[model samples]
Target: MSFDKIRDPRKIRHQIGDMECDYIYTAGVAGERFYIALRDEEKLLATRCEKCNITFMPPRLYCDNCFTELASFMEVPSKGVIESYTITYFDRDGQALPEPEILAFVKIDKTDGGLIHRIGEIKPESLKIGSKVTAVFEAKKERKGALTDIKYFKPA
Candidate 1:
C-alpha cells in the first residue's frame, strides 16, 4: 500500500454497532432446587454424595470428589466460618462509599461449597479468618430467587 493511501483521512471511519443478545436463563437442576428452598422454605440445602460421603453446599447434581451423581439433599446448618474477607471503601465507579462494606467468603459447616456475601453488624478490626457466622435471610415475602435472598452473614 502507498503512503498516500495510508494517510488519507477519507479512508478511515469509525463504525459503531450495538452488541446485544437476549435469553431467559434457567438455573440448572441444582441451583433451581436450592433457590426454591431458600425462597420458600428458609432452608439451606446441600447435596451429599452417598458413595464418597461428601456434602456440597449450593447443592450440586454431581460430586466433585467421586464424580457420582448426587441425589441426597440435606439441610445444612446456616452456621459458617469466615474463610477470607475484605473491607471495601469505594464503589465500582471509584466514588467513595458512605461507609465501608465487609465482604467475606463464609464456609458453611459440613458442606464443600461456601457462600460469598457481605458481613454486617461488626467492626472490621474484630473480623477474623475463622469467625463464626450464620446466614441471615431476608423476610419470606421479600425474597427473590437470587443470592441476595440471604441479605448478609452475621456473627452467630
Candidate 2:
C-alpha cells in the first residue's frame, strides 16, 4: 500500500536508534558471486547476456529475457538516480520497519541495471523521481557476504 504522506524520521527515531544501521540478512540468487563485487571489492557489476545485449543488475546467472545461462560479468557504476520509489516501514518479517525506510528502484548509472537498497540520510518527502544517490558500502575487511555489506545509499 501507500502512506498518506511520508513519515517523519525524527519522530520514528524515538522508537528506533537514530544513528543505527538496519541490519539486513537475506538469501539471493548467485549470492556467492555477487559478494565478490559487493564486499571483497567495492564494485558495481551486472551479469551481461552475451546473446541479447542485456544486463541484469544484482547480477543473475541466467537471463530470463532469452532464458540463456549468463556467464560473463560487466562492471558498472554504483551511482544512479531513483527511477521510482516508495517509503516502507516493514522488516523482512512483515513487521513494520523503523518507519521511513525508503525502498527504491535505483537505476544504476551507465547501464540498464539497478539495485534495490535502503536510502539513508534524507527525509522521505525530499526524495523524488530522479533524485541522485550514491552507494555507501561497509568496510570490506568487515564484510561477510550479505546485504549489510553495502550499508545504503544517501545524498551523493
Candidate 3:
C-alpha cells in the first residue's frame, strides 16, 4: 500500500482525509431573518418542537427526540458554563497555529447543545474546566450572520 497525497497541480483537491470526496461543497447565503435574534439582536435562537415542547439552542429545523418540526424559535441569553475545553495548537487543516488557541465547549445559558467558541482573556494554561463564560458580540454595523458576529467568550 502507498500513503501519498496527490502530486499533481491539475487536481483541485491535492489531499484527502477521512471525509474527503471528489465533490465540491458549499452553502447558500444564510438568511438574515434566521439570525436576527442571534447576531443583529444579540441573543440566541432555539426551536421548540410543537409536538413535544423540546427546546434546543442554536436552533434546529427538527427536534432530535420527537422528529417534529422545531418551529418555535426562542431567544437565549449569552451566558453559560465552560463545560469542557482544549488548548489548540492547530488550524482547521491541522497545521500548527501561529499562536496556541483555547477552544471551549460552552453550554448555552438555557439549552441542550453547547456552543463552541474561542475562549478569550484566559490563557491556555489558565482556563478552568468548569468556569463561567459569556458571549460578546461586535457592534451592530459590523455584525454578520456568521458565528464570529459574536466575539469570543469572556469571563462573565
Q: Per-prediction TM-score, please? A: 0.87, 0.69, 0.72
Q: Point to the candidate with the largest TM-score.
A: 1
- Please report, in order, the local distance difference test score of every candidate based on alpha carbons: 0.89, 0.79, 0.75
Question: Which lDDT tens digits does candidate 1 get at residues 61-151?
Answer: 9988778888768899987999999999999999999999999999999887798899988999999999999888899999997889999
lDDT (Cα, tens digit) per residue for candidate 2, span 93-116: 889765668878888887677878
Predictions: Cα RMSD each: 3.8, 11.9, 5.9
Q: What's the ranking of the predictions by lDDT, best on top? A: 1, 2, 3
- Highest lDDT: which candidate? 1
Query: How does residue 77 of candidate 3 score in lDDT?
Result: 74
Candidate ordering by TM-score (highest first): 1, 3, 2
| Alpha-carbon deviation at 149 in model 2, angstroms | 1.0
Pairs that collide in candidate 3 are: none
The true-versus-predicted C-alpha distance at residue 153 of model 2, in Å, is 0.9
Candidate 3 residue lDDT tens string, 1-156? 433585664565466648756974432222343466666678777666656755676677777787765545677778889999988788889899998888889998767767899888777777887888998888888987677887889988
Backbone clashes in each candidate structure, one number apiece?
A: 0, 2, 0
